[model samples]
Structures are given as C-alpha cells and as structure tokens.
Target chain A: MKQQRDSIPELVWNGNISVEIHQKENSLTYLANLPRHSYFAQILEDLKRLFAPKVALEECWLSSGKASIKWHWPVGVLYDLLSQEDPESATSVPVLWHLVFHVGSFPSSLVVPMGSMETFRTCFFNALKESDYVRNGSSSLVIALSKPETDTYWNSLLNHDFYDYRPIATKLFTSKSRIIPLKIYLGADAPIVQSSASLGYTLGQVLHKQLPRLFPSAVMYSLLKPVLHGIVLPSTVSTDIMNRDFCYPDGFLHIVLIPIST
Target chain B: MASSINAVEDQLSKTLESLQTEEKSSSLQEKIDEIISSYNEKENRKVNLRFKAIGRTPLLRKNVFAINASHRFDKVIRFLKKELGFKPDSSLLLYVNYCFAPAPDEIIGNLYDNFSVDGYLLIYYCVNVAFG
Candidate 1:
C-alpha cells in the first residue's frame, strides 16, 4: 500500500506544472501553477465546489490553500483578468486585487470585493478558529481600510469639484474617504456587531462595480457554500447580502457595515 | 398589377368606413380625455419624501420636502446641495433605506414605492467619509 501510494506523484506547486499534490501529515496541498494542461479544467471543476453563491467561478488560480478570482485571457493578454467595477467599459483592472482563502497562513497582501469585505473577513476569522493560533487564544484579526492610490486620486478629483454639473465629485469623495476598522474575536460563540454604518450611494456604486470581482480564499469558502447550493441569502448576514429577496419591493438594501482593522 | 391596385382601393374604402363609423358620443370623448389627462397627471405627480440622517449625517433644516415624482434622483441630489449649501465641489452620497446608493436616474416614485414607509421614502444621506 505504501509503494502504491508512493508511486502516485506528490502534488507540488510549480508554476509550470499541472495537478501536483504533496501529502503532509493530514493536510493536502495543491499548487497554483498550470501549463495549458487538460487537467486544468478538472481542477476548476473541483474549485466550483468551494465558490460562494452565484459566483461565476469559471476559472481561478489556486495555490497554498488560497484562491484568486476567476480570470480569462483574450488573445494577446499575458496577465490574468481581474474583475472591474464597470464590466462594460472596464478595460483595466482595479488597484485592489481579489483573493479568498480556505485555510492556511494569511497572505501579506490581499483585497476583498467592496460589498463582500465584511463576509470575507468573518469567514477568515472562522477559518482561523480551526487553526493553532486561535486555540492558544493569543491572537485576533483586524480589518483596516487604507485609501489606495486610486481612491486618493478619485477623492482628490471630487475635492476639486472637477464636475460642476454632476455631484460625482462630492459623492465619490465622501463615500470613499476612509476604512472602518473591524476587530473580530477569534472563536467567539456569537456573531459580533463591531459597528454598523448606513451605506451611502457612492459606496453602493463601489459595491455594484467591485463586488463581482471578489474571489474568496479557501479559508472563506464557507460563505460561498450556501450560495452555491442556491440558497439566495443564508440565515447569517455575516455571510452575504441577507434579505436579498426583500430588496426590490423595499426599493433599498439595508447593509450592516462590518468593521475591520488591518 | 391591376388586381393588386383594386385590392388597395378596397382596403382604403374599408379604412374610410371604419374611420367614419368610429365616432363616439361627445360625453364619452370627454371622459376619455379626462382619463388621459388623469394618467398624465399621475405620471407628473408631485411626491413628498422624508429624508433622514443616520450616523453622523448632517441635519437638514426641514426634513420633509415635495418634489415631482417624474424627476430623476439627481434632482433630489441637487436639492440636497442647495439645502445644505454644499459647494458644487463637495461630495455627498444618498442611499435608500440603509443599504444602497441608487442610480441618479432612478425615478423618485419608483424608489418611494419600493422603500417608502410611514408615508416617507427613508433616505439616508451622508457626506461620505465624513461620518467615518
């Protein structure tokens, strides 16, 4: 049995290889690199099992227990396609990136979709509960909002009153100004309401524009499980846009902002 | 070709007869006109909406205001700017309920129908990051 198992190649994450795995103790490791192999399609099939509800999840990059958003290449493009706020006119990707986790070490750099940030953070916290760090009860997760360069440029443009006829300047500036920090207690028994802010128009725009581009990592994959099963809104608001069905008749969506500190 | 022309003539005469016989009583015509006018009035109806501030949203001198239902959402935005004396350069964000910032072109009545409560379409307006 050991010989037969040893004959099966261990999965390794070499950017040029497809379908590599390494078994370490009870943990199964998969690599992110693929080289135009047919198994790439098979790997994507396995990934679909982990997506949140209604995510296209057509294709993605998986490595070290982290999953990036679905991307496509058109003809001559070399880089993976990222989700855009404006898909119709979005020729370029946003400064923020998409990455979801299942369970592993936290990456140094990552970005969640605007509307989905709270859910991703909550899921990340839950995933941490299964890790050694939380069992020791010595750590907590922080969500911090930093104004990236793009945000600064947009805010500055609004501050300048660049468009006199339209209130785009003020709307963008006010809504995109700062990040509300959310501190999550690891392994808590109940959901935390760190802070709640009424969502504004510009933030809605940000959500509509950027929400689609989010790709949940493996650590956060639980949020998408209910979604994938066609449960429109899970019982938990901490997962996604709860009460999505009730949004239309009410003509508005009620969002409880989940705070994060990075 | 001649037969086709004859067919055309017959069709024309039928149309003429139909038109001539289509006249209704003057009272009926008046009622129809009234109905049409009422529909137009409904389309152009003025709506009164109540705006509320949540979190650190600035307070308005008068919270209730009447505006044309036919007006686009942008009109309310402009009205807000005027009421608040916000410089054209400053930023403002509006949301229906507490959740979404609607498109500027969305009609007021549509919003009122979907989200209005207690005779008010609860609008949460903010100066954006000012609250943060």
Candidate 2:
C-alpha cells in the first residue's frame, strides 16, 4: 500500500491564471492532477511554445496555503504578438502606417472612445510627421476646425491661407461642413437608442427621394446615394434610448460631414 | 443491237431516278446547312456583343456592362426600373464569375473593395447581350 501510494503522482492545487498583468485579481483558476513541480514545468512549456523560446519567464510563485500561482513574462513579447494580430490593440502602431499599407483611402469617420480623441489626434499627427509618404511630398495634411475656438484662429489662418496652408490633392478637411442628419437609437439595456428605427425610416424616405439630385455626378449614385444619404439608426442606439427613457431622439444625433483625402 | 439498246434505256432510267433522289437530298442538306450557319452566327454574336444603359437616360448603348459590388446591382435594378424607366427581361441571366457571385439581396458597402466577388477580385460589372 505504501509503495503504491508513493508511485502515484502527487496532485497539484493550482489556482488562478491571469493573462493580463492589470487583471491579477479576476484571474482564471484551475486545478491539475499533477505534482507542483510538473504543473509549473507545464506552464513554462506552454508559455515557451506560445511565445518563442526566446521569451524567458522571469519569475513564478506558488502560494503557501492557497492553490494559486503568480507569474510574470516580458512585455516585449506581448506587444509584438498583439501588434501582429490586432493592429488597433496598441497605441504605438502608427495609424497612418495602417492607413497607407492596409486601407488606401481615409474612412468617413473613425469612432473611438469619446474622451480619447485628443490622444488619438496627437498620435496621428506624430505618425504623419515621421512617415516617408508625407516627408516626400506624396501626401499633405490639413486640419480644419468644425467650430473655431474664437474668430482669431480662423482670421489668422485665413490671412496667409495660400502661403502657409494649401489644399491637399484638391481635398479639403473641415469640420464646419454640414452632414446629412442620422438618427441613432439606444435600447433600454443596450448601448444604443430605442427609437432609432423610426428615425432611420424617416431618413430613408427623405434620402430615397433627395439623394439622386444631391449626388448626380457620382458614378454609382443610383446604387450608393440612397443607402448612404439616409440617417442610420443602428440597434445599439435603440437600446440606449430605451434604457435612459430619452424622449428627444434628435438631440442624441451626431451629424458630422467631412471630406477625406485619398 | 436490240439487247444493247434495251440495256442503254434501262441504264438511263436508273441514272434519272438517282439524279432525282440526289436533287432532293441536296436541297435538304442545303437547308440544314443554312440553319446550322445561322445558329453558329447567333452563338458567335451573343458571345461577342454586350449592352449598357447609363443613368436615367432612355438611351442604351451597345457596350459591355460588368457588375461589381461597387456597381450595386440590387440597388441599380430598383433605380433603373422605377426611376430610369428600364425593365430587365425575365430571361436576363445574372452571371458573376465564381469570385464575384454575390448573395441575393446582399447589401454591398464600401468595404467590398477589400474582398473578392465570385472568384475574381471584383474590378467592374459588365453586361453582355445576345440578339437572335
């Protein structure tokens, strides 16, 4: 009986595994029917396989009484992996590089967390400064304010507009331009407004009649104008409106019309 | 001399009968050839000719029309019928290359350029015509 007991593998009481260093408390816990040493070895092996063998595990600790283990790995390995898979994951990956390499033309709108616009703009400008395309005069950058802080900013820029600032590839970037109104709905529990369906219907009607006249010069106007001209009320808006019991659907609408440089 | 004359008459009759049969067969063959040539010409023309109707204009040109997601056939069909006063025939076969074959009622967006249609990356949408 003693010999049989000794021959059997000792059980390892492993607790939590947290991938993100920031979320150590809410880690995933697991119990493997293997010895403590072997369990640690398995984890190390898994890490080694996931990251290359060049990824060195710094430290690993097993709790005294609790079935928990804590480990730390290099941040460089994580950054490289994240950048390769998810371009938007890290703030360091230049957005212009992605725009140049991946998407040839600029998108109509880039939705980000509401408060992070400044940070995003700064990073975008920095990237443009470093990029070879901009340096070599292949492309130019222009920033137009939707609303000038004061008349002074506009007046100053307007004085030397031809000399100091010039249009890029016949494309103008300005926020002051009027956009087609889009109605968005938020649901009660959902992130969007609930009444967006009605808004979308109304917008669709207006656009169906008006779009052809608006974009007559566009080659695929018949196909694209009607769909794009109307206001979009996504389901996300529906949920938010319902949850908040917001009556003024029009107030929540965001209408920004801007031209993009190709 | 009498036997020779009789034999000559018999040979002449056989030759006349054969000539009549040959004339009928030749006429039938000529008709068949005409039909076959007509069909071949139609097939060739259908393969070569195409047509396109631009915008709300009532004019349709004898030009090839290629279809792409960018062309938005579903949206264009509605516009063409309702606004442009053009109706597609029921027999109008909608063909896309294996790469460009879009699903029925697929709402195409700007992102279509990123992907392929049928099997070929959708460069353009063209229409071919065959008149019998």
Candidate 3:
C-alpha cells in the first residue's frame, strides 16, 4: 500500500500545471503538465526540443500577452500570479496556461538574459542571498555554502528533488531571522510588495501591516485572498509553516493577492 | 511613470471594492477619494538611499541621495554605473545591507520599506572580480 501521509513539501512538489506554449504559426505547440514548484528554466532543455529547433536556447523567451515571463519565479508562482488576469475561470479547474514563445528578441531592459543553466543558477542564488540577508541580517550562511554543496543544492532543484534539497536548505532557515522574505504581488500591474515581518508574525499579520487598509483584519482576509503555489491559504497560517513548507526554492514565500469577488 | 500609475489604479480598484462591502456611509465617495489621494501621495513619496562600497568597488564621492519611490532597482544600477564611470561591460553587483543583490524589477519603494536602515536603504556594492 502507498504511504497514507505524504509531507507537505512532497504534495506541493507533486502538484503539476497544465501548460500550452504557442509557437509561431501554431505549428509547434508544446503541451504538458509541468511541476508546480519547478522553474521554467529547469524544464527548458526538454521543452525547447518541441519548438525553436534552430535558435539557441539563450535567445528564447516566453511571454503572456505583453509581459515577459520572469524565468526566476517558480512556475507555480507565475501561474498563480497570472491567473488573476482571468479570475472568473481560475477556480477549481485546470486551466491550460497559454504562453507565447519568442526567440532572438526579448525585453533586455526589463529582465536579464536567461535560458542558460548558469544564468538561472546565478539568479536563483542571488535571490537565495537576498532571503538570507532578510533572515540573518547578512548572507553569510548562503555565502558559506561550499562549492560542492552549492552544486548539490542547485542540482536538487534542477532535478525537482525536494527531499534532497531540504536538509541542506534547513541551515538557512531560522526562527530568529529578522523577517519572513515575501514577494507579495498585489496585482499584475501593481508594484510587488516586500515587507519585513517578525518571526512570530502570522501571514495575516504581515499582510495587514503591508496593506493595512485592504487587509484591515489580522485574523481574516476580507478584501483579498492570498494564493500560494495555487492554493488559497487561510489567513491563520503562520510564517513558520509558510517558511518551512511553502517557500519557493529561491527561499521566499511568493504570495499573489487577488481581489475577493463578491 | 506608467507602471506606478497602473499600480495606483489597481490599488484604488481593490480598495474601492473592499469599501463597497462596508456599511454604506453618506461620505463613501469622499472616503474613496481620500484613499486614492493617499495612494497618489505615496507614489510621489521619495526614499532616502545611502551607498557604501565593499572591498572591490571604490567608495562613492557622494553617498546619499533621495530617490523617487516609484522607480525600480535597475535605475540605481544605471546611476551607479554612471557615477562610478564603469564601462557598459564592467561587472558591478549591488546588495542591500551588504547581503544580496536584488533583482532589477524590485520596486524602490518596497526595498526602502523592508530593508532600509534609519530611513535609508543601505546599498553595498563591489566589482564582481572578487565575487559573482
């Protein structure tokens, strides 16, 4: 018999998203259920095979409508962040996320060049250091990771192996850290909100402090809903649990806030 | 300019939606206008920034400046590159509190709010020859 209880990380890792990449001329459409916790860069090696056979991977980019996809964000977070654009169809249904693939041209001004493993690696670690700084007042913990250990950590994420990654990552997480690193996106066009929160503060408390008028109550989400890894999180979830289980591989909780429809 | 306006519009809509659920008041429109004005004021707010050089990069001649809150972190990078007189290809990485380099798109207002020290965002930077 299968194990009755799987860890939260495992369950989150197992969550997959139905994706449809629309290539030029619609001749090379790539469709699959991608891992929610994985980065688009992680699967690009295989996904690129379906289209852009002639172009270099480094030249390829993805866009939804007009916004260039930030490759560093967890694919799940991107889905949650983008889902707000069509809130009517976002509930209880597996929506095939449609993305446009562009090769050789990207918004160089807005985002750094991506598609190389090393580029993604650097971006991921840079974000990792940012989180460490918020937690420990410095990134010494992340900087101290040995070369071999760093490679292992990167490989764990690239391979989508959460179990292999957790033990190594546990060092960076501390209950005494200055604040829970959060990239809370209010909307597609809104400026992303990053706020400092004490270790003891619940998710609700943090939201209330960051956007007090909209999130008036610390115990309840009245005007907006917090979606993490595609699940609508109850306001009572503490920072500790969010940090431990729900933090994206880059070491931040990516919360997408959508207005609650009456 | 456009992104900040879009953000303000988004905030207004969300806040207005929330207010609709509140017990109806005679001055609801006034309340909405006040909230919108507050958001606009916030968008126009300025953030204090202090630059400290690490071991690799040289210390800046002038360390402190007031930056518009609506700008993104890349503007700071461009300012540093111009101030330091580094070539386009020269390597420079910036960190907050000497900790980590933020992504280019991170909004200036958010960075100041979360990581600023004594009302200033303590930015540390260095040439990447010593580090990545």
Candidate 4:
C-alpha cells in the first residue's frame, strides 16, 4: 500500500535537528552547535571543512533521528556523499542526507550503503538509452558548469561567459565526482536549453524534463521517465542492472515527480 | 600399540583421498555452456501478465493477458493504451511489482520471471499528466 506523504513523520519532521547554510562571499557560514563531544557532531565538524570557501555547510544539527540541510545554491554534496572512499563504512549522516534529496522521505534512521553516484548515473543512462529516450553519437551534450554561489570566483564570471564558454571549455570538469550542472542538448543541433535551476531542482529531474524537451513532442511519447523508480529505494536487489552492492533494498528511493496540493 | 595406530592412520588417509576425487570438476567452457543453455531455455518460455488499475482509475474488465517471454515491454504498453481507449499522446505509467517502472524495451519474460509475486507478472498502471 502506498503510504501517504504526510503520514511519514520522519520525512516531514521540522524538529530541532536542522542544518542552515548561509551563503557568504567566498565561504558558507555554518551555524549548528551540536553537543561538543558527540560522534554526530564530530562527523559534521569534519564534513564542514570539505568545501571551505567554494561551498560551506554552516550550522548543521542531527537530532531526533531527523536531519535537515538548507542551501540556496547548487553544490556537490550529493556527489561528495556517494563518491566517498568507502560509503559502506561511512557513518549514518552522509548517507541519510543523500537519501533525503533522492527520495522525498527517509524510510529509516539507519544509514546503509547506497552505491556510488557514478554507478547510479551509468545504470540510469543505460536504462534511458535502452528505452530510446536518449541517443548517442548524434546527441549533443552541453554540460553547463556554474560555480556555487559560495565560491569567491562566482561573481567574477560575467553572464556572457555563461553563454559563450561551456563550463567544460573553461576546464571546470577535472573530476568525475563533482556535480556538473548538466544541460543536455539531445540532438546534433537542437536549441532548447534550460538552466541548472529551472529544470527541476535535482539531477534526476533534469534528466527527465530537459532531456526529453530535446526530442520532437510527436516522436517521443514519454518524457523523462525516471531512470530509477519508486517512492523509496531498496537497500539491495539481486536483479538490478547495476552492481548488487549499489541496489537499494526496495522502496527506499522515489524518483517520480508528483504535483503537491497546496 | 604403535603398529595398530599406524594401520588406522593409513586407512584414514586412503579414505580421504577417495573422497577428494569423488566429484569431477567441470571446466570454464562447460560452466559457460550450462549458463547459456539455461538462459536460452528461460527466454523461450511464455508468461502471463496481470494488469490492475491503481487509485481512482477505472477497473479493467479482464485483468489477465498472456504474452511471449521474448516480447519487449512496449507491446504490453501498446495493448493497454488500446484497451483503455487512451489517446496516443496521453501518458501512462506502468510499474512492475508496484515499485519500479521498467523501461519499455525491457523483456517481459525477465520481468515476469524475476518480479512476479503470485505466478502472474503484476503491472500497476496509472494515468498521469504527461509533463508532471
């Protein structure tokens, strides 16, 4: 049975446990004061320094089995979480935080190993291509790279640079794990383009929405259908196309976009 | 006493050797052959699909349909569209096991064999707004 979204209290919780990332010039100011000696606080303290001036996660709190992260600008937190050396060995915080974005709800407080983002992206792309939504060779891909608002260099780039220089052209794509604000141009020369923000907030959304727009509406019957399905992803599955280690247990991740009634 | 211990040790060693060689080891080629044959056999089999409407959607009069295992999932989607009188442009989402949406090109046999709950592959279909 489909659990109503509001019924899942853990997902909807607005408790004391919260993370507030205030964007500052050249650095993000984090403002969470977890207990000094606690293990959760230590994890946050270590992660807080990762992005420094480029992207900062300010006051972060983990309490009552719920965590909240707030950031106005796009950052690579999702990429960092999955690309870590040993995700299975990582403590609960990073894994849960990653899950919060993928699935609108968290099935449990325990942070189990979800596979690397690379594997997820590959599996997703393979599935999409197989379904004929995405094609290669003739597909012109424009990966729009934008500096996170927290980066000091962000203000230096003019709007013309955004239009003229492909982020990849500027050599921003040195690493695979870093979030590449992708603008997928479907055809060899299709011109419909959307920025990183307006194309659905998450990476999954961009794949479904913007990518399909590249195709003729009459030719492509289904728009960006989710490469990964369900309201929640499972921890493991023997039958998933990706490596078994990366499979969600079953119903632990949701990729579908449903309209919310206000 | 020493002679008796020696005799028993010799007997145990002989038994162990015989047990070790009782089973013949298959080569890598033989293992590969076996996997290919089993896969081919499974691919040739036919399967039944059971479709059920979810939410406020109208009920399908006849729920069960039979399809070849080798057929692509697109066939099933096309059939549903015709049966439900859905326009070609209208959106329909089909989920296998009521969990994940299988790609249209995915084989029906593979889905039926792996995810079928009660001898029938259950596909839950929902009419959704195409863009949302």
Q: Report lDDT (CA) for all predictions.
A: 0.34, 0.25, 0.75, 0.35
Model 1: residues with Cα > 4 Å off, grouped in runs: A1-262, B1-40, B129-132
lDDT of 4 by residue, B3-33 (tens): 3223333443454344446634644333323
Encode model 4's per-residue lDDT on A154-261: one tens digit a residue: 222212122232233223222221222222221111111212212113333333333222111322222222222112222121122121111111111212211111
**TM-score, each model?**
0.28, 0.15, 0.84, 0.29
Q: Which scores better on DockQ, 1 or 3? A: 3
* lDDT tens digits, residue span A1-262, model 1: 7764332111100112223443235244444544211122234434444442244432233333333321121100111212102222335332322223232332212322212323222322222221211112111111122335324433422232223312321222223323221111111111111111133323333222222111123223211111111112222333112211211111112222111111
- Candidate 2's residue-wise lDDT over A118-165, tens digit each? 332332322222121111221122223223322332232223222222
What interface Cα RMSD is found for model 1? 26.2
Q: For each predicted model, how many residue pairs clash, with residues at least 3 apart or on different chains?
A: 36, 41, 0, 19
Better of 2 and 4 by DockQ: 4
Q: Worst lDDT window (10 residues) for model 1 chain A? A: A72-81
The interface RMSD values of the models, given in order, are: 26.2, 32.2, 6.5, 25.2
Off by over 4 Å in 4: A1-262, B1-38, B129-132
lDDT of 3 by residue, B1-132 (tens): 224345555676666666667745625334434554556466677889999888957878999999998788889998899899988667788888877778777778878876787778998888863365
Residues B53-132 of candidate 2: C-alpha lDDT, one tens digit per residue: 32333443333333433223354344334433446442122222211223223223221222323323332222332210
Q: What TM-score does model 3 score on chain A?
A: 0.90
Q: Highest TM-score among the candidates is held by which one?
A: 3
lDDT of 1: 0.34
Question: What is residue A243's positional error in candidate 1, in angstroms?
Answer: 15
